[model samples]
Target: MDGFSFFIYAFLSIFVIVSPLSGVVTFISLTSNMTLHEKNEIAKKAVILACIIAVFFAVLGNKLLGVFGINVDSLRIAGGILLFTIAFDMMHAKISAESITEEEINRSQEREDIWIFPIALPLLTGPGTISAVIVLMGTAPGFQEKIMILAAIVLTFAISLLMFLFSRRIHRFIGYNGMLVFTRLMGLFLAALAVDLVATGIKNIFPMLGKLV
Candidate 1:
C-alpha cells in the first residue's frame, strides 16, 4: 500500500481496537464521585500513561518477541484470536473480560490508582493493543511506515484522552444504548481487522497457501 493508505489503515486499526467509546462507560462509573476537574485529571493521566505504554511496546516489542523466540506471524494469529474474542464481547455490548472484569471494576472504584491500573494498563493499552502495535511494526517495510504506525498510536490515544475528558457529557448525550450501538459497530470493524491479520499471518507462514489461492 502507499504511505497515506497505510497510515489510514494503521490509524483505523488502532482506533477500532482501542475502542475509546467502549471505555467511556467504565470511566464515567469510576469517576462518578469525582468533580469534573478530578475526572479530567484522571483522564489526562490515563491517556498519557496508555500512550507511553503503547509507544514503548511498539518500539521494543519485536525485540521482546525475539527474546522469547516467538515469530511475528505467530503473534499475528494469536493476537488476532484474542482481539476477535474481545470484539465478540463488544458486539454483545458487554464489557470485555479480557480487558477488565466486573470484580475489577467494582474493586477499582475504591482504589486511588485506578487510572494506572484498569484505565491505563488494561483498558487502554491492553495486550491486544500491544500485540497489534508490535505486529504493525514488524510488518512495516520501512522506517517511514513504522513512524506512521507510531503516529497512529499517538493519534488514537489523543482521541481517547478527549473522549475520557468529556466522558460524562458524552454519556449524558449518547445514553447507554447509544454507546452500545457505537461499540457494536466498532466491534464489527475490529472483527474484520482480526480476520485479516489471521489470514495474513497464515499466508506468511505458509507461502504455499498463497500460491494455492
Candidate 2:
C-alpha cells in the first residue's frame, strides 16, 4: 500500500486490534479494590507505559526480531494463544492465570500499584497489538509512513485513555452483572480473533494449507 493507504489501514487496524473495551473490563476487574483515585492513576500509568512500548517496538521491531531470529507469524501464534488464555478466563468470570497470579490478586488489595504487569505488559501492550505495530511500522515504505504508524499508536492509546477515564461511570452503568455480560461478550470476540490469528499464522507458514479443503 501507498503511504496514505498504509496510514489509514494502520490507524484502524491498531484501534480494532487493541480492543480497548476488553481493556476496560480488565482494568475494572484488576482495580476493583482500588479507589477512584488509584484507578485513575493506574490508567494514566498504563497508557503511558503502553505508548512507550508501542513506539519502542515500532522503531526497533525488525532489529529485535532479527536479533532473536523471530518472525511475525510466530508472534501471531504466540499472541493468539495468550489472548485465548485471557479470553477463556474472561468467559468464566475469572482472572487469567497467565495474566495474573492468585498471589498478585491477594496482594493487590494492599499494594499501591499493579499497573506494570497486567495493565502495561500483556493487558494493554500485549502480543497481538505489539505484533501489529511492529509489522506495520517495519513495513512502512518511507519515513512519513513510519511516522503515521506512530500516530496510529498514539491515537489508539488516546482512545483507550478516554475509556479508562469514564470507567467509574461505566462500572456504575453496567453494574456487576452487566460487567460480567460485557466481559463474556468481549471474550468471545477475543477468542475468535485468537483463533484467526493462529489460523493465519499457520497458513503463512504452510501456504498450501490455504488451498486445502
Candidate 3:
C-alpha cells in the first residue's frame, strides 16, 4: 500500500480501536475529582503506553501469531466479536470501573491510580486495537508501507490522547446529550465495521461459505 492507503487504513483502525467518543465520558467520570495536572499526566501516560503497545504489536504481532498457529482470518473473526461487544456497550454508554461511583468518590479524597492499567491496557490498546495491528502487518506491502502505517497509528493515538486530556472542555462543548448521541453513532459505525471484518474473515477462510449461504 502507498502512503495514502496506509493513512486511510490507519485512520479507520485508530478510530475503531481507540473509540475516543466512548472514552470521553470515561475520562471525565474517572477524573472528576482530579486536578488538571493529574488528569494531564494520566492522559499522557495512557497515550504513551497505548502507542508503545501498538508499535510492539505491529512489529512482533505476526511472529507471535505464527508461533500460536493462528491466522489473519481467525484473528479478524475474533476481533470482530470483541469489537461488537464494545460497540454494544458504547451504544448504551456503559462506563467501566473507570467511572467513579458516589461511594468510591466519598471514600477517597485523592485521585486513584487508573492511568496505566485499565485505561491504557485493555481499554485503549485492547483486543480490537491489537487485532488491527496484526491485520495491518499481515497486509503490508513493504517497508515503506509499514512505516506509513506506523505514522498513521501514531497520529491516531495522538488525537485520542488529546481528546482524553481535553475531555472536560469537550464535554462542555458537546454536552451530555450530544456526547451520548456521538457515542451511539460511533457504536453503530463500529458494529458495521465488525460485520465487515467477520464477512471478510469468513470469505477468506471458507471461500464457499459465501456461496453456500
Q: At residue 171, give the lDDT of candidate 2.
A: 68
In model 3, which residue pairs have backbone atoms overlapping below 3 Å?
none
TM-score of 3: 0.86
Instruction: Rate residue 77 of model 1 by lDDT.
Output: 94
Q: Which stretches in model 1 have alpha-carbon errors above 4 Å?
A: none
lDDT of 2: 0.77
Per-model TM-score on C-alpha atoms = 0.98, 0.75, 0.86
lDDT of 2 by residue, 121-188 (tens): 76678766777787676556788988999998999899888888788787678776886776687677
Residues 117-212, candidate 1: write the lDDT tens digits.
999989999999999999999989999999999999999999999999989889999999999999999999999999999999999999999899
> For this target, which candidate reaches the highest TM-score against the unseen true structure?
1
RMSD of each predicted structure: 0.8, 3.4, 3.2
Model 3 per-residue lDDT tens digits across residues 104-185: 4344435465776566776678777888788877767888888877887888889898898789999999899998888788
- 1 against 3, candidate with superior TM-score: 1
- Cα displacement (Å) at residue 84, model 2: 2.5
- Model 2: residues with Cα > 4 Å off, grouped in runs: 1-19, 23-38, 135-149
lDDT of each: 0.94, 0.77, 0.78
- Candidate 1 weakest lDDT stretch, 10 residues: 93-102
Ranking of models by lDDT:
1, 3, 2
